[model samples]
Target: MYAATRIKNRQRVCRTLVAALLMSAGAGAASAQDQPTISMAINQSPWLDSFVAMVDQYEEETGNRVELDVTPFGGLLEKIRNSVRASQGSYDIVNVNSLWLSEIYSGGFLAPLGEIEANYQLPEGVLSYGNTTNWDASAATFSSDGALMGVPVNGNVQVLYYNTEIYEQFGLKPPKTWDDLFANAKAIQEGGEYYGFVPRAARDSIVYNFTPYLFSHDAAFFRITGPDQAEVTLNSPEGLKALETYVKIATEAGPPGPGNIAQGELIQLMATGKGAQAIAVIAAWGQLEDPNASRVVGKINAALLPAGPDGMIASSAGHWVAGIPKNVAPEKQKAALAFLDWFAQKERQVDYVRAGGVPVRGDITGADLGDEAAFRFIEAYSQNARHAVMGLPFASAAEASDAMALSFNRAVIGELTQVQALNQAAADLAGVLERAGFTVSKLPDL
Candidate 1:
């Protein structure tokens, strides 16, 4: 019900903005060449700190100022939406999740990045997969009519973190398949010193844990046939099976009170050596590997998520994508591209890696991947990265994500059966699509 209200409100905002754009087209045309004083949005992370430092260096070298503003992820999105509605162009560049791509662009609020991309050579290994001519096959977060509209600034994937000593003590190797993971984890728990697996089973992180498995089995939240297209596709047998598998793992191998395990707390359990294995995002593990910050130091090993019946397991790509605001001046947009190209440089990216950015470049893997566990992570990321799911552009992504959480939360507490939980979720998702006037026929088949 909350989701339905949010959808209605968003549509009204979009409608008002469209009418305003039509009335101000001429004024907008004239302001296109003005010097673009840019405002940018970022989620808090170590990489963001590095980004600010680099921006300072660039300003010093070029004598042109680029203002850097930081906001929580939620606050940033709200501000961007409100600013665009007012035709204020408060932000010149924004780092956002993939689902925001279509809505922002369709609202005539974001500028296409093709002109910027073509004007400068992008850094090597920085979203090279997304730069190809055939965009559907590329890893780009947003593409339309053969043009890439965003640049990937981070490498995001789910991976397994295990204790090396636990594996060796049990004479076990890193799990290459889901069954292997289950067996190894179960046996290791016999010592009673640690549990076999720890996962983020909480409401906030349930989708992150479940969606990849669904996609690996060739299922998805929506089917898309085009940019302005999408339809519900979660009711299929494959999707149900995937959800069943997710419930099985959590029920069998995950810690007690699993639904209470928030993402941060779950990772912290793994880092402190209370658990032998964890399924989580790469960034969290990377922080644990840092000696200065981590309490476990030199104990945990990160590896690939094991395969499912279909093939190797897949993960979602949660990247920070950069796009220009349509309101920004053209020359400034050009400069922003130049800055992005340089910022994405492999050498500069090394700085990002040192600051704990996931290695996005292929050549940097293997020997260049440094220490043993880090290599394990990079290897898994390289193999599974291509299969990672791109988030959908629902009118209310936050709402949909929340609904998914509620269903899983109920299942976690044994309040609902797997079938009941997913059934409720599917109905909620369908209602959201209908309310937004979005048809599932436009999305890609899972």
Candidate 2:
């Protein structure tokens, strides 16, 4: 509710600012065709706040104006989808989560940035504009057949967070392996005073939290063996074992009403020292880092994510990218690129970092943040990326994620055995994908 409210209030403020800008410029009724006014829509993120500040700086220098539209995270996707489908050009540049890049590019809704990048002289010490973590900033998400949509804005990582006081009191070392994690969780929960672990089991949290385990077990959502053979791969032995591990820790170490625990509550429980450990997004640690937000500030420590039999720590990347709209005027597109180039400067990136954005470039690490816990999170996240998975379409992702949540809830409640739950989940998921027109032959036959 707080995040939603913040998003609403932020939108109100942005609208007021844009209205004021329009009034000062003495323009009325959408002013003459392609007269240099640009519109941008972004979800409420601190990184975007910094980006807006950069936009202001760019405007002052170039005399180019930008009208920003801000919305809540929940509302942003729907808005983008509706607007892009109409080709109404509602947004000149849109800020979106990295996961949605494929869908946006594939839909042919976004404009190419290749020509624009070639024309602009980016600020010093910045990667070329439109760079995302998925391809090292050199490659674009689209094939030669499509436009280069979405410029990468911020980079976020996932890490394992633990309660320092709890570990110390129980004489438990940070878990290095899944076996150690299970043993430690059981030992810590034996006292029955508090829960030892909490896995995100509600809605989307399930997939965000579960993907790493699958990766650690050396499984993937689809076999990228070939474009023609991409298929579902969630039922293999390793995949089933990964799901089993989730059932073991969540059912055994979590609270009885496990399905009711939302991401915020889980984080709060960990921050208030109730949970012994959890795998959390890097930005989540900022809550513990804040003196007013965390009661146990110094009593928290971050560790690298644990390994499974494969010895690889799986993680997800949360990032934002800016892309142009299809059929947009070349001059307007050039202006967007100029603005983006300025926004990617090192100094501006530092500003974004200070405002809570994890840097996308590899140069910023533990040394960059200067906070021990934050540094630890960076170290863990950087190492874990070796096993990171790419994101799929937003709606498909939400559906796929919900399937895992339902299975997890059932397993945690003992309504189904782990294998039974995973098998059922695999079957249901295969049906869902088939309906969505995906093939199931090349993926692991779980």
TM-score for every candidate vs. truth?
0.81, 0.79
User: Mind giving the per-residue lDDT tens digits that candidate 1 earns over 323-409?
Assistant: 677776677676666556545655545545544456555555655535545445666666556556654544466677786778877
Candidate 2: tens digits of C-alpha lDDT, residues 1-446: 12222433554434112111222221111122234867777777645554555455445445667777877788988878877777466777787776676566656676656655553322333322223322211222323233445456666556778887888888999888887898888988997876888777775567667777887898866542333224567777888888888778887887767666777888898877788888777667778777888877777777777888968776765557777776566777766765565556554454456545555444456655555354455555555544445533322555665665677567766787777777766776666655555555533334
Q: Which stretches of candidate 1 lie above 4 Å from their native place? A: 1-38, 60-64, 86-88, 116-124, 128-146, 225-229, 366-376, 440-446
> Residue 43 of model 1: what lDDT?
61
What's model 1's TM-score? 0.81
| Candidate 2 regions with alpha-carbon error over 4 angstroms | 1-37, 46-65, 118-148, 224-229, 369-376, 385-387, 391-395, 442-446
lDDT of each: 0.62, 0.63
For model 2, which pairs clash? 130-151, 151-322, 235-446, 236-446
